[model samples]
Target chain A: GQQVMQIPQYQHVQEGEDFTTYCNSSTTLSNIQWYKQRPGGHPVFLIQLVKSGEVKKQKRLTFQFGEAKKNSSLHITATQTTDVGTYFCAGFDAGNNRKLIWGLGTSLAVNP
Target chain B: SQTIHQWPATLVQPVGSPLSLECTVEGTSNPNLYWYRQAAGRGLQLLFYSVGIGQISSEVPQNLSASRPQDRQFILSSKKLLLSDSGFYLCAWSTESYNEQFFGPGTRLTVL
Candidate 1:
């Protein structure tokens, strides 16, 4: 069974601070995706990285896939009150079913 | 524009009770559908996925079953609910050859 692991299970920061969360997998992945879930809200697709060593940005958020496609990271610049939520990374093993394995989300709390 | 819709934003049931949840996608044809469950303060877990009508693959062997009767309609059912079934259920869809998925608002199920 393939599993995705995320670090810093929880994080709290001031509204103007920056935050970063790491995601790693037990096996190689075909691609990786990032999602954000606000409190009491469903997961929202943020971005997807398919190429090794790829990086993407959405306004204040940046996502990167490792050169080996076995790890990833999400960094938020200048977090705001609205950025308070959980961030998740999902990926699929190369030889397994297409069902995505999700990482335990990093819960982000921003203090104004 | 494709949109995913899930019914009954919240539900509460007792153990051994039957349960059904519906998810339908509009503006997309023959999309891949997925069912996911997320426990409070945890990550999402893959439960089932359907690539087409009457075609389903279960990721987790549990008390739940999924069916896709139409191209855009997916249903999750359980003959006997358990307390552990309490969680936030989500439905997502993606187009062929593309991995980015769009998620619905999700259903909050509480099995007492």
Candidate 2:
């Protein structure tokens, strides 16, 4: 069975601070996706990284995929109160293209 | 434009009661549908996925089952509920051409 693990199960930071969450997979992944779920709300798609060693940015957020495709990270710069949410990383198992493994989310709490 | 809908937004049931949750996708045809569960303070867990009507794949063996009666309709059902069934259930959809998944507002279930 494929598994994805995320670090810092919970994080609390000041509004202007930086935050990062790391994700690792037991097996190689064909692609990885990032999602954010606001408190009491549904998860929303953020970005996807496909190529190894790939880095993509969306405004204050930066996402990176490991060269081996077995790990990834999401970094938020100068976090804002509105950025508080649980961040999750999902990976498509290389062995089973149809199966997507989800990491336990990193819950972010930004305080003003 | 695409949207996913799930209902009822929240539910409460006694132990041993039957359960049913519905999810539907709009503005897309023949999309891949998925069901996931998230316990309090945890990450999303893959439950079931359907590639088309009458096609389903179960990711974990639980007291639950899923069905796809229409191209864009997915249902999660259980003969009898347990306390462990209490959690937030989410529905998501993705097109064949893309790997990013769009999620629906989740349903919060509480099995008393």
Per-residue CA lDDT of candidate 1, range A1-112, in tens?
A: 7889999999999999999999999999998889899999988888888899999998999899999999999999999999999999988788774678889999999999
Q: What is the lDDT of residue A28 in candidate 2?
A: 92
Q: Estimate, for each residue in B1-112, the C-alpha lDDT of model 1 and write its tens digit.
A: 8889999999999999999999999998999999999999988888999898999999878999999999999999999999999999999999953488889999999999
Q: Write the per-residue lDDT of candidate 2 for residues B65-107, one digit (tens) a residue.
A: 9999999999999999999999999999999624889989999
The per-residue C-alpha lDDT of model 2 at residue A40 equals: 92
Off by over 4 Å in 2: none
Q: Could you tell me how far off, in angstroms, the CA of residue B23 lies in candidate 1 after the best superposition?
A: 0.6
Tell me each candidate's TM-score.
0.96, 0.96
Question: What does candidate 2's lDDT look like per residue over A56-92, in tens digits?
Answer: 9999999999999999999999999999999999999
